[model samples]
Target: MLRALGLAVLLAATTIAAAPSASAVTRTAVGGGTGIIFRLKPTPETPTSYYICTLTAVGRDSAGNLVGLTNAHCFIDEQGNKLVGERVYRDTSPAGTAFSPAPIADSRPDLETGAIGTVTYVSTPNNLLNSGPKGLDYAVIKLDESRVAPTSTVGQVTITSIGAPPANGTRMCKEGHRTGLTCGKKLGTNGIWFTHLIWTDGGDSGSPVVSGQTLVGNAWGAQHSSPILSIIDAMNTQGGVGAGFHLAT
Candidate 1:
């Protein structure tokens, strides 16, 4: 199982105080929350395999269907619209090693290929580049529960409810496929921004941002080594306004 690495030096910019106590949860090493993201092609032809981001968590739609939360950019095409009806796969390993294991003959048997999911809903494309009035960079993928469950590899995360936008210096952390878990204080005021101490990579987008086991937001974009997260309320707002849905706690 992959464990999270700390990036202490990166958070020097912010003064994070002792955080409020949070509850605990349990999870497995693989096939849980926070996994490799992939964009499966629609055609019968060979699917283009590429690492995009992390599948933040297993969510439930308003209709009670299982779903996966991720960044809208992960499912968007060049034209800007989130790719709907696309087959996506969230592999167990952060490095996507589950897709291709060692020993060519053992690859098929060793890899967990049942992590297939579909893009069900995404917030409308808006000025997500900046902290606009709307935060619309999240997407939901209806997961095939036969494979992926509502759990995390590092540990189980009991998301009781969406949290308010974090204030500056509010201690928080996130678990990403590429960087694992990293903690820092909130920095930006325009939107939700964590201190530069928390690390992220190309495949770390869509990761879950939390504070003491509570859901805060999802990784949207980043700059200067600091990851930008969409406010949970904004995500909830978009989910309702765009898809008539609510964020699954």
Candidate 2:
């Protein structure tokens, strides 16, 4: 596995305490919830097309802003709308259900590709940016104000509190829409860079790596060609994740 060396630094910015408490974080579904998915064209010769893969809910940032996380390759296109995007729609549940879909306005453009038409469950913001590692293969989209409202059925993941990276062999866990919830350990933490031997796959990218409700990192690429979470600190310093050179607050 390719191991990169970097130093982890404490962000000087004051931690945003106004964010939701750890108890607010919840897991609605595994590999199921309402989230945006991207479909890429097979080859240059193939007609440009895209499709919605799955719908899942990510956690809100320190600012109480909900961000959409997914695979970067999933957002590619050949012609128009190369970055295929859509909104999440939770399956309607019975009354008093614990999980529900967030309220999102129809703000996405009406179009079609590969027989798929306009996605109306959630609106696609005009300023969404690809805030993830190019080689790591992840993408993040900031949810607009109109879509930030809490959902009755959609549970949110809490960003783990920022801290020094875990030492080698430290135990950790991840709750993703695909793999449900699984546990692993910190295999390496060389300076601010390292890799883990966690078991993850394609749909697992963009899932948050947590140690108790604190945000350690988001799943990026894997160590053994599997899947792994790319530490947000490393990505911020390396200029992979976050927008306009701004790190997550």
Candidate 3:
């Protein structure tokens, strides 16, 4: 089995590298309630390296293309470099045996349901140092609708609306492929740096953070993020209007 603590440390130390651009394609947007764990494999290398992360948010860009959200660190490696044309795969079974041909009960990403996503947008690590810090540590992945099931279809979960940023002691919860339905009180201001007092481990990165039914933020390193609105604003300014990505409702 993979060690969460070790993997967590490696993720923190890794940085992203530039990837060759691919022809732009329209992605099918998905709504919240998608808590599938997926694997990311960097390409053009002889030996493949894999990282596990969760799908936090799903939606379409301005052009009505489907997209998903995750953490930028998922695309980074210990070498402090990023991979170009990275491919994402859905976990067809339990976290420990996702690649196995055998199946488990309630195991997702089976023949009928699986998702393939390509890394699209990721927040710059420099945000922590920039004069105007945005507290962003997120990424967006464009999904292939034909292969992946929407959140509404797989589970009745949906991120209908985005709630205000979290404040200290605010109650929040997260759904992850590795750990399902863990909730706790937040530890910081709603619009500032905040960490939930929830239980989170390595693969939980990219899981959605929520307060009640409202969307809050995607999991950072393990359980952290800038304000939820701050991340959205960064996407607007950096991702531009064409990205057209937003929380549902």
Best-matching candidate per lDDT:
3
TM-scores, in order shown? 0.63, 0.45, 0.68
| Per-residue lDDT over 1-249 for candidate 1, one digit per residue giving the tens place of the 0 to 100 score | 000111101111222122122222222223223554454332112333233566655556555766666666666664655678766644433242223311211111112343356776765433434443444466667766554455433433444445554677777676665555666776754333333344555566666776776666665545211122343345455563223333443
lDDT of 2: 0.35
Better of 1 and 3 by TM-score: 3
Backbone steric clashes in candidate 3, count: 11
Candidates' lDDT values, in order?
0.47, 0.35, 0.54
Cα RMSDs of all predictions? 12.7, 15.0, 8.4
For candidate 3, the C-alpha RMSD (Å) to the true structure equals: 8.4
After superposition, candidate 2 runs with Cα above 4 Å error = 1-35, 39-66, 77-136, 150-157, 189-193, 221-249
77-115, model 3: which lDDT tens digit per residue?
556454434566564444431123122232333222333
Per-prediction tally of clashes: 5, 21, 11
Q: Which lDDT value does model 3 have at 107?
A: 30
